[model samples]
Target: MILKKEHIQELKNKLLEKKEQLLKESNLSHSIIKELLTEPSYDEVDYAEVSSDSYNLNILREKQLVVLKEIEWALKKIENNTYGVCEMCDSPVGLKRLKVKPHARFCIECREAFEKEQKNSR
Candidate 1:
């Protein structure tokens, strides 16, 4: 099915909002990391806790970076007029799926198949 201009604009707006939120979160994560670096740990327990928290923060930052990249890719797709097209199947992705995951590169069927393949491979 052909996507309507209004729907495309709505999806774009949602993507833009998500991108802004992600940027803010990323900046906050960086600031927190810097603050953590400056603070000194007093004892072994404190050091261990700090280390664990630092590790968790690093993981979260990495995840945010990945999501930010996905968002950027989605925006590019919007600009290219291929926002809701599945990369793998070359089919229009469902509006509901797109609403839930605007950065998705595949339709639900393709995504589920891909995930199953990955799970089996693992």
Candidate 2:
């Protein structure tokens, strides 16, 4: 394994734990959205409170979903023997970075470049 056996196990455990937490949170947000959308007083309810809660739920769900997607991607990378390699620069992302952010697909330098590009685009 590119990762030491122990490290690989730890990564897997962390990803699984995070995945479950995200799924639960995401599902709860989705359920709330559905409830709000189909509320009994569909037209009579206070739009401000409902909209505010929905907006907050959306942001939270969005962040959690992104993390879930990243974890899934990382797991696939591990299966493909491509884990720990930077997707952008093709450099090995050190174990320390992987430990800190197991879903990281790029090294610090490449990540910085990518973020800069993203900021410019926005």
Give me the candidate number with maximum lDDT: 1
TM-score of each: 0.75, 0.74
Stretch of 10 with least lDDT, candidate 1:
38-47
Per-residue lDDT for 13-63 in model 2, tens only? 888787777767667554553343321210211223445777877766656
Question: Best-fitting candidate, measured by TM-score?
Answer: 1
Stretches of model 1 off by over 4 angstroms after superposition: 28-51
| Candidate 2 stretches greater than 4 Å from native | 28-53
Q: Candidate 1's residue-wise lDDT over 1-122, tens digit each?
A: 35788887888888889877977887856455434332122111112243577787877776666666677677778888877899888999988888898878788898888777765764
Prediction-by-prediction clash tally: 0, 0
Per-candidate local distance difference test = 0.71, 0.70
How many steric clashes does model 1 contain? Answer: 0
TM-score of 2: 0.74
State how far residue 33 of model 1 sits from its true place (Å).
17
